[model samples]
Target: MDTRRLYSFIKIVDAGSITRAADILHIAQPALSQQLSALEAQFGQQLLIRSKRGVAPTEAGRALYRHAQLILRQVDLAHAAVEVSGRAPAGSVSVGLAPYSMGAALALPLLRSVRERYPDILLHINENFGGVISEAIMTGRMDMAFIYGAGPLRGVQFEPVRSEDLYLIGAPTDGGEAGEVALEELAEVPLLLPSRIHTIRQVVDSAFQQAALRPNVVGEVESALTLVNAVDADLGATVLPWSAARAILDVRALTVRRIAHPVIRVQLSLVTSDSQPLSEPALAVHDLFLELVTAFDKE
Candidate 1:
C-alpha cells in the first residue's frame, strides 16, 4: 500500500469527514475516497463506516490509524532531518500573505535575505485576505501567513508580530488640520469600510457599537487598495491600517486623524498551523518576518 494512502486515511479520521479532510489536504473528495479504499484493500478489511452524521473508523480502521499516526510522525521527522542537513537549506516553502499586509515590504526583504543566505531554498508567496490565508494554513496549503486582527481560531496558532495604530482617512481637512475627531461627530460623514467579516471591520464596528453610533456608510470594499481609492475620491472616509494609509497618503490631498473615546489599534500577527511545527524554510521565513518588523519599529 502507498504510504500516502495511509496518510490520507489518518487525515480523514482526524477530520471526521471525507469532505473536510479533502479540504484540509487540498485534494478532491473522490480522490481521497479512492485512497481510503486502496488502503482498506491492502489491509484486507473495510476501514471506514459512513452514516448520516459523517465517517468513523471501524475496528480495523482504528488499528491502522494508530500505526499510521506513528509512521507519519516518523516520516515527518525524517523529512525534517533531511532538509536541515541537505545541500544549501534546499526545499520549497509556500507562504500566504494577507492582501494589505506589509508582506510586500517585509517579505521581499526576507526573500532576498534567504536567497542570498540559502541559495537552494525555493520560496513561494500567496496574497490573499485574512480569512483565506488562515484557511490555507489550516488546510496545509501554506506553511504560514501574515495576518492582522484578534482572537483564537481552532487548529491555528497566532504569534503577534506587532500592533499598528489605526486612523480615520479622508479627503484633506479644509486646511490639513490634524487632531482627534469624536466618533459620534464622524458618524454623520459618509463612510467606507471593509466587509463585516474582516477582523479590522469587526474591531471598528465594535467601537461604534460601544459608542452607540451607526455610521453613514457609503460602501464596503474587499481590499485595502480599493477602500483607500474610494476614500481618495472623496466618496467618504474609512479606518485604515498605518501601513496601508502611509502608502496612499498624498500629503496635499488626504487627511488622517485619531478617533476619540476609544483609540483603535489592530494587531498584525503571524498565523501557522498548530497541527505541526513549521518546516525549516517556513521557520526561516517566520524569523525573517521578526527581523523586518523589528527594523521597521526602529525606523
Candidate 2:
C-alpha cells in the first residue's frame, strides 16, 4: 500500500470531513475525495459513514486507522532515528494535562527541561479537565495525561504519581493561616467548588458524605483563577489540593490551612492508553514528567 495514500486517508479520519482534510492538506476537495475513493477501491471495503455533523469510521476504517497510526508513528520514528544519527530523538508529541494537576508550576519547568535536553523534539501540551483528557489519550489525540487516579479508569492505564492532601483556602482577611481545620469543619464554611462531577469536587463531597457532614456550597466555577480569585475576594472558602492552590495563592496572597480530623488525599496519577504506541519523543517527555512531578509533589 502507498504510504502517501494511507497518510491522506488517516488525515481524512482525523479531520472527520473531506473538506477539512482537504484544507489541511492544501488540496482541492475533489482531489481529496479521489484519494479516499482510490484507497477504498484498493482495500475493497467501505471505510467511512458520512453524516451532517461529521464522519465516523466503519469497523474496517477503525482497523485501518489503528494500524495507520502505528505505521505513521513508526515511519516518523525511523526518519528521526536516521536524521539525528542517534544523537537525539526528534518528532512531534502531544501530552494532556488535567486543569490544575499539571499547572504552571509543573508546565514552565517541564517546557524548559524538554527544550534543554531534547532540543529536536516538538512538544504539544494540552490542558483540559480529566474526562476530556482521558478520552483524548484513549483515542490517540493525546499520548498521555495527568489525571485524578480516583476517577474512572475504564480506557486508560494510570500510574499513581503521588497523593495530595486537600486544604481549606480563603482570603487572608477571612482566615489567614489559622492552622489545620477539621474535615467536618469545612461543612460549616461557605464554599466555592467545581461542579459536583469534577474529580476534586467529587472527592471533597465523598469525604464530607462519609463523615455525615454536608458542605455549605454557595457557588460553582471551573477555572482555577476564578475559583482562587473568588476566595481571594472573600466570596467563600474552598477545599483543594495544596498544589492546586500554590501558584495562584502566591499571586493572590490567599491563605491555605491543612484539612485534618481526617486528612483526605486525592491520588494524582499519570495516564496512558496501552493501545497507543509511545514514540521516542513521547517516552522522553513521559520520563521527564515523572521526574518533575516527583520533585514538585510536596506529599
Candidate 3:
C-alpha cells in the first residue's frame, strides 16, 4: 500500500480511535475513515472494528500493523542509503569548523589533497564557534569539523589531532618573542579578546581566574584576524591560538609572547557525528585530516 494509507493505518492503531487519529494526523475524520477502508479493501480483510469508544484492530489488522511498521522503516532506510550513495567521494562534503581552530589553516591542506586525490569531492567550509560546529555535525548538515576541546561533547566523537599553547600576543614595541609571560602581566595590560563563547576565550578566562587576575578587556571582536589586527595596531594585546598569532608575528610589526603561568595549551580535535554514517567524500576528508595531523606532529 502507499505510504499515505500505511500512515493512516498506523495513526489509527496508535490513537485507538478514528477521530483521535484524524485530529493528530490533521485529516478529516471521514477522510481517514475512507483511507482505512480503502487499505483494508486492498488487503481483502477486515482491519478494524468500529465501536462507541473508538476503533479496535482485528487479528488481520494487528498482523498488517507489524508488517507496515517494518515496511516504513525499510523505506526510510532505503531513502537514506540512496542519499548517501549519491554523495560519492567526488561529491560535495560540507564541513563546519571553529574560526580559530584548524578548520581554517588545516582545511587548506585537506582541500588540496582532496582536489589532487579525489577531484570530484566538493569542499564547503563554514566558520563558526565550537558549539555551532558541534550542532551542525549532529544535525547532519556538516560532514565533519575541526574544533578545539570543549570538554566532553556528547553525541560527537573526537579524534585528537594536535595541541598548541595559547600565547599572549602584543605589539613588537611592547614585547618581542622574549619568552613566556606571567598571568599578572595580562591583568595589568589592556586586552582585545574574542567572546567568552570561543574555546580559546574560555581557556584564557580560566587561566585568568586561576591566577586571580582580572584582565582589562579593551575590546571584544568575533574573528581571530580582527582580534590580532586590533592587537597589532596596539589597541590591546590578546590571547590567541599560536597558529593564528604565528602568522601575524612574521609581519615584523607584531611580537608573540608565550603565557607562562597557568600555561593554557589547548588540543584541537577532528570531530564527527556518532549517529551519522560518513559519506565517501567525508571519509577521504577525514583521512586528509589525519595526514595533516601527522605532518604537524613531525613539525
Cα-based lDDT for every prediction: 0.75, 0.79, 0.76
lDDT of 3 by residue, 1-299 (tens): 58879978988998999999999999998998899989988999999998998888899999888667656654654565566675545566777777766556666777688788878777887889888888777655677888899357777898887788877677343453367777777777788877889888888888778878787888888876676567667888777777766544443556667777667888888888776667666777888778877886577
State every prediction's TM-score relative to the real structure.
Answer: 0.73, 0.82, 0.69
Span of 10 residues, lowest total lDDT, candidate 2:
170-179
Cα RMSD, model 2 = 3.5
Model 2, residue 42: C-alpha shift (Å)? 5.4
**Per-residue lDDT of model 1, residues 81-154, tens digit only:** 58677454567677777655566466677778878877877888887778888877765667788888654998
- What does candidate 3 score on TM? 0.69
lDDT of 1: 0.75
Of the pair 1 and 3, which is ahead by TM-score?
A: 1
Off by over 4 Å in 2: 13-34, 41-45, 50-71, 150-155, 171-178, 297-299
CA shift of 290, model 1, Å: 0.4
- Residue pairs clashing, model 1: none
RMSD to native for every prediction? 6.1, 3.5, 9.1
Angstrom error at residue 168, model 3: 1.5
